[model samples]
Target: MNNETTNSFIVQIEQKQLLLTALWPMRFEQVQQCKSWFAQSAVKAGTLAYGADRVELGLSFANESFTFCYEDYSESFWVTADSAGGAMLLSELAKEFSSLEIR
Candidate 1:
């Protein structure tokens, strides 16, 4: 990761809107896999909506929460984390997927 990407991850203490990408565009199956990962993480109040070109995911964990929109065309994930815990959760997510880029 570049300095900008690394710094952004550290500088954003509270709410952050991040664009997550991989080497290739993500498919619907990949999105489903992500959802399953969240479920395994014990997220609360989770919801998932699938569309032809996108998938939306919302999850809450105690005081931390995040929402994600995966765009198939761009193979990117738009993520918003609203709290410190949420930010930490996002960090954990990035660790889980080594190919994920936080930008």
Candidate 2:
């Protein structure tokens, strides 16, 4: 059972109190290619969140809320939601793949 997270992004818009994220193994190049598609998906999903190359999700009554961004150097993607408080909802939004932890 491999349980390591990849493909993550942090969607943050604190100025609006809306936070969202994703935890999937989406490569930086991949994200770069599908920026428009991701943005449109959020809109279609009714999140209405936007960014230059990322997607932001608004806080929803269902308890999932987040805003995301990318860090190219570390190849790190993050999702920030209060988890125990349904923040994981944001985490769930990610389309990810699983891999064994390399230690």
Candidate 3:
């Protein structure tokens, strides 16, 4: 396998952190596809937590040109990224992806 480090994006909603890192076979078009997938996905509330009022939410974004994943939650259903700390982390990764040259 290639040892090169591919670019990846991370998501954090509240205290939960989700990572989305790019994989091998770098290609600008492929990266763009991933970016588009992220934009198209709808962030829905996850499941109920143990003893909190917070609701977990699922973040579905592109892992590659043809892959995706549904993040897990511990104690919530819906997460707010507009005014959450994790938004910044996600933004940073997006910015990094934007700067990267696909291949």
Highest-scoring model, lDDT: 1
Q: Output the worst ten-in-a-row residue range by lDDT, candidate 3.
A: 61-70
lDDT at residue 75 of model 2 (Cα atoms): 45
lDDT per residue (tens digit) for residues 1-103 in model 2? 1123343333443322223245455555554543344432332223434345454333332544444444555444444443445444432343321221211
lDDT for each candidate structure: 0.57, 0.38, 0.32
lDDT tens string, model 1, 16-57? 655654444455776765666543344553778888888888
Best by TM-score: 1
**Per-residue lDDT for 7-101 in model 3, tens only?**
43322323333333444433432322333434422322232222222222233322211112322222211223332444444434344333444
> What clash count does candidate 3 reach?
15
Taking all chains together, each candidate's TM-score versus the true structure is 0.56, 0.34, 0.22
- TM-score: model 1 vs. ground truth: 0.56
